[model samples]
Target: MTIFHKLVSRFLISPEKKNEIGFCTDLDDILRDDGKVTLKIDGNKITLDLSNLHERRYAACLSTSLRYPQYDIDNLLMAKFVRKGDRILDGGANIGLTALHFLHFGASFVECVEALPWLAERIREIDDIRISVTEAALSKRSDGFVDIAISKTHNQGSTYDSSVIAKFSHIFGDDIKFLTTPTITIDSLTSGPFDIWKLDVEGAEIDVVNGALQSLKDCPPRVIFTEFWDERVHKFASVVSASHPVAYRAGITKDNYQLELLDMKTFEKNSEVFFPISPTYVFLREDCKEI
Candidate 1:
């Protein structure tokens, strides 16, 4: 741990937690193929779960996700607009890494809601029938129940709302771990229509975009990869000024980890060039273009 302390903690970390997480797995093919770390996606495989650590970015974010697998470039630009059969809607499906990158970029379907019913049975132990995980959690009210506030040494997130996970004061309130669950509204957890909407849900992404405002006005997701925190940036500018269209605020390009979108007025007049703890946005709606 000392190539000069990993180049001074890689110049004091940033580049969106190093390559904007969500695409990694290789570090000598997962510690020389032993304590589990395999990954193939779309073509299957999966594995992972290197027996948890007290939490050091979950073991340096899975060995910096296999030693900087192109630093995840915002989930590789949301897996280049996932097309194959597309139907993603993985709002906070943590242990499922954006539903295994929209089922390895062919989507075909993916529900993975997740409120930690044991990480939705550990994402159905990765069996994948186009995934369905779903432990329940959506917002803008749906019936009731919604406590959440997990953090177990931070980075693994979850928030129902306590003013949106109370700015993570190291996982606030008795260092988080409450739970409760049961909240529906994304059109009552969908009965139809879906075409990409991988919201990370750290700060409730504005109560799941205010309970999916009538399912984004009757199914309107061509893209909506959520998250742009500055204490939720006014709940992502009040759900992108009421239901969508705020493309590009994406980040992670401190020097080569590609992707740097930014346009909403130069990303709200430069918030120190993003990477301020949750900067992933790719909204696109107004007569869309590029997923």
Candidate 2:
């Protein structure tokens, strides 16, 4: 075991340390190296093997697993909305975690859209079944280059990474060196119906949605999962609950694209913050009946 793992183990076994102390070490072992880790979620046993993958962002995976006990990437993949032989779209598919999750859940085909070449290359390394990795940003326009502020760290995909943002600006030096490859609208790239659609494009959720308006209207998926932060965007659809106090919406909408307000929950400051935003809502399509 690595020194980090040993340290974590020591913390975990310490009588004075809290129960949460050593948990991350165990998670590190599962993520950094190949091993079988069993997670008891919702009274059910789910086993994961990370033997073939590289060790990056293992902590985020572990944190996400602990935070959303019932809604891990695996659970989201196995969700009723996802099925075998179904086509799924993963926008801002950072490191292919969600894509891998969907693949594990049995998605026949997954189209992963990523803008950054560095992250896209990592996704390309994942050789799995029926997975297509696209290194392009999805926007409303047919084709054009956009400024994509890259993050040095794996988990920091947002444009707000303070250190990276400063470094990027300095490196580019008033020029467009930080600008990434060309971006394409979903309408221009996709040709057929899609089963599931997930968008986690930081703050550009609206632009991505606008780009795929045609597909959403024509071949509306059973579920549309997008991250929303600013309340202004909520006006476009209905304001579902936010994920955390400062996190975006995990809200669900109906088939007609109207926001569903039922079962809405408010956020409390003292409560555990899972997402970086508030009251993450899940939007379900109106036409989609619960499965």
Each candidate's number of clashing pairs is: 1, 30
- What are the per-residue Cα lDDT tens digits for candidate 2 across 130-189? 668888887767678777765433333444223445544543344333545687777776
Q: Pick by lDDT: which candidate is best?
A: 1
Instruction: Score candidate 1 by lDDT.
Output: 0.63
Error of 1 at 111 (Å): 20
Per-residue lDDT tens digits for candidate 1, residues 56-166, read 223334334333423365467766677788788887786775577666667777888877787778678888777887677777787788777776653366676665566
Candidates' TM-scores?
0.31, 0.63
Steric clash pairs (candidate 1)? 19-71
**Runs with alpha carbons beyond 4 Å of true place in candidate 1:** 1-48, 51-113, 120-135, 139-141, 144-181, 185-198, 201-239, 243-245, 249-255, 262-291
Please report, in order, the local distance difference test score of every candidate based on alpha carbons.
0.63, 0.53
Worst 10 residues of 1 by lDDT: 25-34
